[model samples]
Target chain A: MTTKDIGPKNPVEQGVTQVVDFVDERSGVKNSGRWLMFRNIPAGTSWFQTLGFTAMALFGMQAITGIILAMYYKPDPNTAFGSIAHITNEVTWGWMVRGMHKWGASVMIVIVFLHMGRVFIWGAYKYPRELTWVTGAMLLLMTMFMGLTGYLLVWDQKAYWATVVAVNIFASAPILGPYIGDILRAGPEFGPDTLSRFYSIHMLLIPGGIATFIGLHLYFIIRLGISEPPWAKRALRVQRDEEDARRKAARNREAGLKGSVSFPPAWVDDEQEVKR
Target chain B: MKKADKVAYDKDYAAAKKDGKPFFPYAIYKDTIIAGLAILVVIVLAITVRVEMGEPVNPASTDFLPRPDWYFYFAFELLKIFANQNALTPVIMATFMVPNILIILLVIWPFIDRGPERRIWKRPFAMGTAVLVISGLCYLTFLGASTPEGIAKGETLPLTGLDAAASAGEAVYLANGCSSCHMIKGVGAPGPGPELTNEGAKGWDNAKMVQWMKVPVAPMPSFASLPPEDLENLSTFLNGLGTKYK
Candidate 1:
C-alpha cells in the first residue's frame, strides 16, 4: 500500500526481485500465488500434515540422483555391474550421488508409507478426498515399481538373481504368468534384454506415471482444501463449508452466471465484496 | 470466502493466531532444515560406504549366490520359507499372491474403514491389522536377510586327466574356460554346473553334448560364443570322462 513496503533501494535485492518478478509473471501466480503460499488451513492443522510434502521433496531427491546415475550406467550384462563399480571408485562424488540415490529410495518409501499412515490415521481420505486417496495409491504402486526396476540396473550377481526371482513372481499371475514374465524379462529367462527393459521402465515409464499421479493428487488437494484434522470438529467444518458453498451459489445466481469452479477464500471474499 | 465461509475461517484464523505460526518460515523452514539433514545423511553414507558388487556373472558356476537388496528380504524370505515347507510349493504364491494381495489390501483399506473416528483405540481392527503386518514384515525381513540362497542348487560334474582331455580336445576345452565350471576330477574349484564327472554316462554321444552347450538354463551364462571347433573339443572332453552309468 506504500512505497516503503515495496522495499529499500538495494541493487542486489533489486536484481533478485527482477528475476523473481520475471518468473512470477511467466508463471501467472498473480492472485493464485497467495493461494499457494498462504492458503487457510484448518486452525487445527499441524506438522502432521506436512508428511506428504516431505515425501514429495524426497521424491525430487530420488529423481535428481537417479538421472545422474543413468548417465554413466550401461544397461548391458557385460558392463552394467562394472560401470557401477567405475562410478563408485573412479568418478568423483559419484559414490555419494549413488549412495544418496540408494538411501533416498529407501527413505522415500519410508516417508511415503508414513504419509499414507498419517492420512489413514487422520481419516483424511473420507468423504470428498476419496480420489486423493486413489491417486495416492497409484503413486504408491509406481514408487514400489520404481524401486524394483531400479534394483535390476545394478547388474551384479545379486541384482541378476533378485530380478530373476521377481520376474518369476510376475510369472505366478495365473494365466498371465508366462506372458508377464516374457514382458518383464524380455524372454523366457534373464538376458541382456532384461536389463535394458528394466532400465527404461525405471528411468522413464514409472517416473512418468508417478509424476502424472502427483499432479492429480496435488490438484485434488488444492481444489478440495486439505482435509481438516479428524480431531477438529468435523461436523462444524463440513457445515461451514456447505454453507459457504450455498452462499457462493446464491451470489453466482445473482450475477447471472452458474457456479463454475470452487474458489478459495480470497476470491470468494472478493465476490462477496462486489455483491455488497 | 463467501460471507459465511469468511466468517468461519476468520474466526478460526484469529483464534489460531494466538498460538499458530505462519506456514512459510515455519513449515518451509522446517522442511529446509530436514532436507539439508537428509542430504547430509546421504552424503555421509555415500562417502563412508561402497555398495558391494560381487564377482562377474558366472551363469554356469553356482559358486556365487544371488540375493536381493535389503528391502525385498521379506519376499525373499517368504519364498525361502515356502520352499522349505514344500519344494513343490509354487514360487508364484509367495511372489504374486502374498505381495500383490498385501498391496491390494493397502489400496482398498481406506474404503473399508470409513468411519467418523480417528482415535487409534477407536480403530482397533485397523490399527491391530497394521501393527501385525508391520511386525510380521519386520520379522520376516530379518529372517530373510540372515538366510542364504541355495534352493536351485547345482553340482559340478567331476572329471580327470591333468594333461589331456579325451585325446585332442584339451586346447578347445581350456580356451573357452569350460574347465572352470566343468572340471576333471579334483581339478578346479567347486562350481554349480552339472557334474560332468561322468557326463558321458548320461548317454548323450558327442553330438548331443555339443548341441546342449549352445544354450543352457538361466544363471548359467550362455556359452553361445564358443567356436564350432571349441564346442566339439569341449563336447569330446566332456563325453570322454569315460564311465558307465551302472
Candidate 2:
C-alpha cells in the first residue's frame, strides 16, 4: 500500500507498520524493496523470459540439498565411499536428499542451457545488456564447473576415473596444463587430499563465485529492464509507423517547402487503440 | 549498435515501460509458475529415477571406464575424434583448443554481434551459428551417450591369428583392462578411446609402441609401470593387428 494508507489500520496492521517504519527509517530498506517490486516491465515479456528465474530456483534447490548432504558426507578418501553408502542406505530420508541433489544437478544444467538458448534466440544480449550477458556467461561456466567438481564428490569408480581424465585434459593444455592438474589433484596424483580438495572447491569456491556473478547479473537485468519481444504487435506497429513517417517526410521534401513539414500525431489512447 | 540506435532503444524502452504493467504481479506470476514447474520436474525425476550406487573407487584398478556425466558427453566424444595423436587431427584440438575457443566465444558473443536488429530472420549469421553450434553439441552428446561401456569382465576380444607373443600380449591386454577403452573386432567400448581393431595398419615397430605406452597422451594413463617383458609382448601383439593378427 502507498504511504497515504498509514493513517487508518487495525491494531495488527498498525503494529506491523510501526516495525516496518522503524527499519525503513534506519535503512531505507522498505523503499528499496518497493522500488524493486513495483517497477514497470514491458507488457510483452513472454513466458520464455522466465527461464533465468527457473534456473536460479534450481540453483537454490541445489544449495539446500547440498547442505543436507554435507552434513553426512565425509570427504576423506577412506571414509568417503562408506559415508555415501551410509547416507544412501542408513540415514533417514538421506536417499531422497541425495537423489534430489543428483537429479537437481542434471535439471539445473538443462534449465541453464534453455535459458541461454532463449537469451541467444531473442537477441536479448544486445545493446546496453552486454555486461548482463557476460555475467550470465560466467554463471554458465561456473554451473558447468559445479557439475565437474560435484561429480567426484560421490567417490564412485566412474566419478573418480572421469575426474582423473578431466584433470588430465586440463593439465594437457599448453604451458599451464601441468600446474592446473597439480592444483586440482593437490599433488601430482589423485590421493587422500584430492577428494577433500574437490569437496571444498565444489561446495565453497565455485558457489561463492556463482553467487557473486548472479548478483551482478540480476543488477544488470533490473537496471536495463526486461527486453521486449521483437515480434510483439506493438513493436511491429512502432516500426511500421516510423517507416511511414520517414517516407512521408521524404515525399513532402520532394514536393518543396509545404509550410512546416508536419508529421502524424502520437499513438492513440490505450482503450481506443484496443477497440480498433 | 551505433550511437543513434542506442539512443532510440533507450527511448523506446522507456515508452514501453511507461505503458507496461508492474513487476509485482505480472512478471512475477510467470516467473513463479515456470520456476515452480521446474522444481516439480526435478522432484518427480528424483522420485521416479532413483540414483543408484556405482562401485566404490579403487585407485589401483584400471578396470573402470572413466565416463563423465551426460552433459560433458560432447567433450568426452571430442577426445575420441582426435585420439590418434596425429598431425592432422591433433589431440590438442579436443583437449585444449576447441573447448577454450568455445568458452571464449561464449563469453564475448555480445560484442561479436552488436547489431540493433533483434528479429531472428534478419540475422542470418547469428541464426546459422546458433543452429550449427547447438546441433553439433546435440549430435556429439548423442554419440557419447549411445556409445557402449567397456566389455563386461570375462568377455574376450573377437580376434584371430594369435602367435605365442601376440597371445601373451592379448593376455596382457585382457589382464590390464585395455578393453575398457578400445575395441578389437567390435568387442569393446566405442569411445573416450579410438578403436584398435586395425592398429597394426600403422606399421610401427614394437619399440615405438612400447615408447608410446610409457608416455601416452592425456586422458590415456601411462603403462610405464608394467614389466618390460609385458610391454614388449603387448607391443608385438599391437603392431601386428590388422596385418598379422587380423
Candidate 3:
C-alpha cells in the first residue's frame, strides 16, 4: 500500500505531479485544500456538518434543473401554463428536471433548517460566528422567498391562487401594505404582466440573493472552521490560565523582579547585565 | 491546555495519524465520489418521476380552492383561523410576524446564549427555545396541511410602546375582549361605540378617564371591576396613543 514501495512511478503520474507543482507554486491552491481537509474539527461532528454540504449540493441540483426548465418556460400567462405542460410531456427529460427542482426546493429548506437546529443546539453561533448565523438567516429568508416566487411561475390554478393568497398576506401589512402587494402582484390583479415579473424575480433576483448570502455564510464557516460540541470531555480553560500565570510568576522571581518595581532600576537590564 | 494535556493530545494525534494519508488524495477522493453519487441519485430520479401540472388559472371560475404548496400549509391553517373574523390579521400573525420573530430569534440567539456550554442539557434556555420553535412550526404545518386554504385577512393592532405598563394594559384590553366592541387603530370588529384610538386627545386626564370608566356614557358599559392601578395604566396607554399618533 505504500506509494514509494510501488514499482516505478509511471510517466503519467510524473507529468501530473509536474503540472500540480506548477499550478500550486503560483496559486498555493494545494495549501488551501490541505487546510480545508486537514483542519482540526471537533470529534463527533460528522452528521450535522453533512447536512450543510448536502443542502449546498441540493442547491446545485436545483440551479441546474431550474436553468433547464427556464429554457422552455414562457412568461406569458396565456402560454406559461402551456409551456410547463409542453416541458413535462414534450421536452426530453424535462419532467425529471422540473420534478427534481420542485422537490429540491422543499428538501433544501428542510435540510437547511435542520442544519441550523444543529448549529443552535451546539451553541456554535456564539460571538465569533455571529456573522455566519446572520448570513445563514438571510439565506433562509431568501430561499423561502424563492420558493414563493417560483411557485407562482407555473401560472396554473393552484399556483395562481396560492400566489394570490401570498400577495394578499403581504398586502395586509399595516403600512405600505398595498404597495408591497402591488410589487408582488405587479398590479391590482394577477394578469399577463404579473407572470413575467415573477419569472424574473424567481429566476434571477431571489436565486441571486440566496447565492450571495450562502457565499458569505460559507466564507465565514471556512474561516472559523467547525465548532466543538461542549459535551466532549474538553480540558478546563481556567486550569490552563492558572498554569500560565504560575509559570509567569516563577519566571519573574527567577529574574529577581518579584514585587520590586520603582519605575525602571529594579527591572532594567537584568538579563544583559548593563550598568545603570 | 496544561503541558501534560498538551503532551497527551500530541501522542493521541500521532497515534491516530500513524497510517493516515494527506487530505489531497484521501479526503478529496472521498468527497468527489460522494458528489458523483449524489448526481447519480438526481439523474435516476429525473429519469423516472416528472413534475406535475394543473389546469391554467381562470379568475372567472371560483370553484377550485387555491391552496399553497405543502411547505406553506401551516400558514394556510393560520389564514383559516382568522378567516372572515374581520377582527384580526391572521396573515401578519401567522405568515409575517411569526416567521420574522423566529428569524430574529435565530439571529440574536448567539448573543442571548453567550455561555460556552453547548451540551443540550447544559444550555436549557437555548435548547428549550429551539425545541419550542421547531415543534410549534411542525405542529402548525401539520394543521395547515389538513385544513383547506382561504384568503389571508389582516387586522391592525397599533399598540406601539413596549413598556411593561403599556403592554400590560394592551393585554388587559385584548384579554377583556374590548376589541369585540370598541375598535383601536382600525383593529377589532366595527362596534356601535366610538373609536378609542384618540381618547387622550379629548383633554381628559387619567383621573377623568378612570372616573368616566366607572360611571359611563350610554351604550358604554362601566368596567367597574377594573383595579385602580390598571385603570391608571390603561388611561396612560390611551393618552400615549393619542399623542404618538398625532
Candidate 4:
C-alpha cells in the first residue's frame, strides 16, 4: 500500500479502478465518464499537451486581465477617457495590467485563429470533430465581439467615431442590419446607454457564452483526443520501434544495459507498443 | 463487426477508468473557489466605479461651430470644394461617383480576391489595394481638415452711398426677411442666405444684386416681396458690411 511499492505499476489499470470506484460511490450515470457508457478503449494518453492547452492558457490570461481592467473602467463617455488616463498614470501597475489586457485581447484573437488553423490543416474538422470546430468558430466570433465591445468602453473621440462608422457599416447589411444596429446601439443614438449596454455584454453576457462554449469544447477535445498529423500513419510504425528501443534502453540503463529481458517479455513490450 | 465491437468496448472501458477520478486532486473545491473569487471581484469593481456625465447637448447654437467628427471631415471638406463652380473641373468625379465606385469595389473585394492564402506577404494585391485606398482617404481627409471657413475668391458687389444706405439697409434687412437667408457676423436664422459681410465688395454690380434679390436662383431663395427701395437698401447694407475685406 506504500507509495514506493506501487511505483511504476500499471497506471492505466489503477486509473480505471479508481473511476469504477468513483462511479460506485456516486451512483449516477450523469457523473460517469463516457468510457463507462461506451466501454473498451485504451487510456493514459497525454492528449491535452497541444495547441488546445495553449488556447486555454491564453483564455486564463484574458480572464485575469479583464477582471483587473473592470476594476477601474467606467463606461460613461465623459469620464471614460479621464478614467483610462488615471489608470495609466495614477494606479499602481495599472498601466502594465491594462497594456497586457489590451495586447492580450489581440493575442487571444491571434492564438485562437492559429489554434483553429492547426485544426483545419490537420483535417480534425472532417468527421466527429466537426462540432468541436463549430464551437471553436463560435468562440472566435465571441472573442472578436468582446474585443469590439471593450474598445467602445474607452469612449474617446476615436472610439466614438470609429463605432459610428462601424455601426453605419452594420446598417448597410440589408433590412435587418438597421434593426440590429439600432438594438446594438440600444436606441436611436450612440450615447451613454449604448456604452452601458456594450459594457454589460463585454463583461457578463459574452463571457457567459464563451464559458459555455469552452466547457463543450473541452469535453469534445478530451473525448476525441488530439488528432494525429497526417505523418502519424508512417510515424506510428517507427514510433513503436522507437518505443521498444527506448524501453530496452531504459531497462538496460536501470540494470546497466548488460542486463537482458527474456524474449517473451520483450515480445509483450513490442505488442503493447503496436497496440498504442 | 464483432471484432470492431470488442475493440471499441475495450477502448471505452479503458477510457472510463482513465477518466473516473477528478483530473486534479482538488478539482471541485479549486474550481468553485476560483469562480467565486472572480465573480466577487467583478461585482465589487462594478459597484465601486464612478461614472460622470458631461454637459447636455444643444444643436441650435452658432458659436459651437458645427464640424463633422474628424473621420468624416474629409468628406465634409470634399462636399464644400465640389460645391464650387469652376473650369477644368469634374465635381461629380470627386464627390459622388468616385466615392460610390470605391465603396462598390470594397463591397465586392472578398469575392474578387478569394485566394485561400491569408498571409499579408502572399496577398500583395489585397494589401496594396487597402494601403492605396487608405492613403488616398487620409490625404483627402487631411486636405478637408485644413480648409478654412470663409468666402470664395474673385467675388464682389458694388455699394453706392453706403453711409446713409447702411442704416436704411439694416432696417430693410430685418423687415424683408434678409436675416432669414443670410448670416451677419455669425448670428442669424439657419437658411441658404448668403453671408452679408463684405458682400458688395465682391465685384457684383447694383443691377445684378437687384436682379438676384428680385428672383433667387439655384441655392438662393427669392426676395420678390421686397420693393425696389427695400432691395436697394438691403443690397446697400450687404455691400457696406464687407468693406473691411475689400
Candidate 5:
C-alpha cells in the first residue's frame, strides 16, 4: 500500500530484503533462532573476543585524547614543552588524558603483540591469511614508529637526549647512515626544526598511512570471514550433508517420489546449513 | 549389495553434490556495524582533543649543564668513562656499533629462531638471550645514572704537600703533555681527552686521585715513576684547583 504498491517494491527495500533472505536462505539456522541470539551479542565469545574489544576501546580513548593534545601542542621546538606544561596545569583533566594516552600506547603495543601471538599459535597465518599476517607486522612497526616520533615531539630533556642517542645510533649505519640520521633530525643537529618535522610526521603522516593500511587490513579480514577450527569445519560439513538429505526427503515426502526435485533445490538447504 | 542399488546410490551422490550451497553468504550488516563504530570513534576523537605547547629553546647559556635526556644518560655517562684519548676511539666504536648490530640481529630473529615450537618454555635459548641482553642494558643504564661526573680526572691528580697545590697541579699538568691532548678552561686545543677544569669539584678525593694516577691503563700512561710526594703534590694541586679556578 505504501511504496510497495507503486512498484513491485522499492529497490532499496527489496535489496535489503534480498540480502536478509539470502543470508537466511543460505544459512539453515533461522534468524530468530536461539543460537543466533547468542552469536549476535558482543562478549559472547571467550577471552580473545574480550581482548579485541578492549583494544578497540583503548584505541578510541587514544584518538580522543590525542585530538585534545593536538589542539594545544606547538610543533615548534621553542614552545613545545611550555605548551605541554600549560595543558597539564591549566586544562581540566588534561593530565588524565595525557596519562591515559601514554599508558594506552603501552597497552596497545602489548595487545598487538598478544594478538599476533594468538594468530601465530592458531596457524591463522597459513595460506589465505598470509597477507593479513604481513599487514599486521607492518601495522606493528608503524605503531612503534608513531610512538617514537610522538616521543620526540614532546621536546623535553628526556625527548632531546633520547633523540640524540637514537640519531647517533642511526648514524652508525655503514653507508648512508649519517645522511639518514641528518634527515631524521631535519638538520645536522636536534633543534626546533627537528621537533617540528617529527611533530608533523607524528600527527599527520604516520596516522594517515596507518589508517589507510588498517582499511585494507580490515577489508581482507572481513573477506576471509572468521576462520573456523578444523574440528568445527568437519562438523559443519557433516551437518550440511545431513541437512541436504533431510530437505530432499521432505520434498519427496511432499510430492510423490516419482516427481523428484533436482539436487539444486536441496543444495539451497546445504548452503543454509553451512551458513548456520 | 545389488548392482542396481549401488548404481542408484552413486547417481544420488553425484546429484547431491550438485545441490550443495554456495561457499559464502551476504551477512554484511553485522561486520558493517562494527567497522562503522570503530571509524566513528576515531573520527570523533580526532576532532575534539587538543595538544599543548612548551617554551622556546635557547642555545647560548653556559649554565645549562647541557645534559642529554635520561634515556641517553648511559651513553653520555659512557662518554665520561672513556674521557682519555687512548680509550676514546674504542669506546666511541663500541657504544655506537654494538647496539646497532644487536638491533639488526633482533629484526632477523624470527627467521633465525625458526623452530616449530612457540612456547616460551620451549624456546630457552632465545628467551635466555633476550633476558640477558635486556638485563645487561638495564645494568649499564643504572650504572651510568649513579656514577658522578669528573670523578675520573680527579682520581689521577698528585697530592704532595704544596700550599699552592692548584697552581702546582697546573704546572705538573703542562709538564706532562696532558695539555697536548686535553683542554682546561677552554684554553687548550681540542684533542682526544675530556676537559679537566672541574675534575675535583665534581666528586674526587685525594686518595682516589693518587691511586688512579699511579697505575693508569690504555689511554692515560701510568705515572708510577713519579715520586709519591710529587704525586701527592699534584693531587693536592688538582683538588685545590677545583675551588680556585671556579
Candidate 6:
C-alpha cells in the first residue's frame, strides 16, 4: 500500500516488477518466499538453533565437493584406488578437493551430532514438534550412513577391510541381517560391484534421503515455528504471572466469594475469545 | 501432552511470536557466522592435515589394520569391550544390540518423554541420559584414538618356544595381520580381539582352532581363504601358547 504511488520508478524497475508479479500470480511462490523469510520466531531463539542450518550448509558443501570429486573418481574396485591416487597426485588442486571432502565428512558428523544434542537438551522435541524430531532423527541416521558408505569409496586397504568387517557385522545381525549385508555388498561377498554399490549409496541414495528428510524437517520447523528457549526471561515471567493469577482466583474462591466472583479473569477472557 | 497442555503451549508461543522478530537477519546472521566459521575450520584442517593415500585394497592380503574413520571410533571401541564374546558381554551387544537400542531410543525419545517440562534442570532423567551418553561417547572415542595400532612395524612377540611348526604358525599369524586385532606376549594391538598371550590355556585342539578360524565370530572376518596348511600352522601356534611354548 505504501509503495502504490511509488511503483517502479524506472522502465527497468517496472519490467523487473512485472516479471516478479507474473511469476507470483501463477505460482504464489513469492508470497511463500516472503512468508518463509519474514516468519516471526521467538526472540529467545539461542545460538544453538543455528546448528540445523549449519548442518544443512555442510550438507550443501558436501554436495559441491562430492560432485567435484565424482568427476575424477572411478567407482570400480580396481580403478577406484588408482583414481583416488590420480586425484591426489596428478590432478591440479585435486588434493585440496579430496581433503575438503574428507574433512567435510568428519566436520558434518560433528555438526549433526551437536545439532541432535542441542535438540535433546532443549527438549524441543516435545508435542507437535515430535514429527520434526523424528524427521531429524532420520537425517542423523542418514548422515551416519553417508559416512559409512563414503568411507568405502576410497577403496584403500584400511577402508576395504574395515568395510568387510562392518558388512560382516551387518550380516551377523539376525534375520534380515544377511539380506541387508548382501544388498550393501551387492552380493554375499565384497567384490568389484561393492565399490559401485557403495558409491551409488554414498552419493545418490543417502544424499537423496537426507535432502528429502531435510525438506520435511524444514517444513515442520517453519510451520510450527522455532521453539523459544524454555528458560527465557519473558517466558518465565509469563508463567509466573499466570500462576499468580490462578492462585489469586483460588484464594478469592476460598474466601467464600465463589458465587459473586467473575474469577480467572484473563484465562476466562482467553476461553471466550477461543469460543468466538 | 494433554489437550490442555497443547492449547497452553500454542497460546504461550503465539504471545512469544507476537513479541518476537522475523527470522531473517536476526537468525540468518548467527547461522552465517557459525556456519562460515565451521567451513573455515574444515578448510584449515584440510590444509593442515591433508588426507593421505593408503595402500590399495588387496582383499587376499588380510594383513591390514582395518581401521575405520575417526567418527566410527566409538563403535570400534565398543567392539573391543565386548570382544571376548562371553555370555556376560556377547559380541552381538556391540555389533547389533547396543547400537540398535541406542538408535531406537534416539528416534522415539520424543514420544517417550512427552512432558511439558523443558528446562534442563527440571528434566533430571533427560539431563542424566544426556550427560551419560555424551561422556560415554567421548570416552570411547578417546580410547579408540589412543589405543595402539594392530602392530608396530617390525615388532615381534616375546616367546620362548620356536619349533618349525610353531614358527610357521607365528609367521602365518603375523603375515595375516592378526596383530591388528589381537595382542600376544605384550605385542600387537589390544583390540576388538582377545589377547593370545596364554591362548594355549584354553586347551583347544588345532582342529578346533582351525575350524573357529574358518568361521569365527561376527565381527571377525573368516580366514577360510587362507591355505589349509597355514590355518593348521596358525592353530598349532595358537594352541601351544601357554601350555607348552611359554
| Among all candidates shown, the one with the greatest TM-score | 6
| lDDT tens digits by residue: candidate 4, B198-218 | 465676766777788765432
- Worst lDDT window (10 residues) for model 3 chain B? B147-156
Best by DockQ: 6
Clashing pairs in 3: B89-B154, B89-B155
Fraction of native A-B contacts kept, per candidate: 0.34, 0.82, 0.41, 0.01, 0.03, 0.80
lDDT of each: 0.67, 0.87, 0.66, 0.55, 0.55, 0.88
Report candidate 6's fraction of native contacts.
Answer: 0.80
Q: After aligning candidate 5 to the native by TM-score, how far in Å is the CA of A203 from where it should be? A: 0.6
Every model's DockQ, to 2 decimals?
0.18, 0.63, 0.19, 0.04, 0.05, 0.66
lDDT of 3: 0.66
TM-score of chain B of 1: 0.53
Instruction: Report the TM-score of candidate 4, chain B only.
Output: 0.40
lDDT of candidate 6 over B1-246, digit per residue (tens): 866667767877787888899999799999999999999988999899999999898888898987888888999999999887678998899999999999999999998999877878879999999999999999999999999887776777788867999999988999889999998877888879888888999999989999999888778898888999999999999999987787
Q: Which residue pairs come into collision in candidate 6?
A: none
lDDT per residue as tens, model 4, A182-266: 8888985565688888889888999999999999998886676444443333233323444567777787778865556543433
Writing each residue's lDDT as its tens digit, candidate 6 over A181-232 gives: 8999899778788899999999989999999999999899988999877777
Question: Judged by lDDT relative to the true structure, which candidate is superior, 2 or 3?
Answer: 2
List the TM-score for candidate 5's chain B.
Answer: 0.38
Q: Which digits, one per residue and each the tens of the lDDT, describe model 5 over residues A1-276?
A: 554544336799888877877888988556545333332221112234233334555556667878999988888766777887877778787766676676566666666656655555444454445566666666767777777777766665445544554566566566787797788878866655888888778878877877777777766755553333222222323344556678778878778884465566433344344344
Residue B160 in candidate 6 has what lDDT?
85
Ranking by DockQ: 6, 2, 3, 1, 5, 4
Q: Can you give the TM-score per candidate against the true fold?
A: 0.67, 0.90, 0.64, 0.44, 0.48, 0.92
Kindly list the per-residue Cα lDDT of model 2 for residues B1-246, writing each as its tens digit.
Answer: 766567667867777888899999999999999999998988898888878889998876666788899999999989888876678998899999999999999999999999888888888999999999999999999999888787777787777889999999998988877887787888877656788888999999988999999887788877777889999999999999988998
Interface RMSD of 3: 9.1
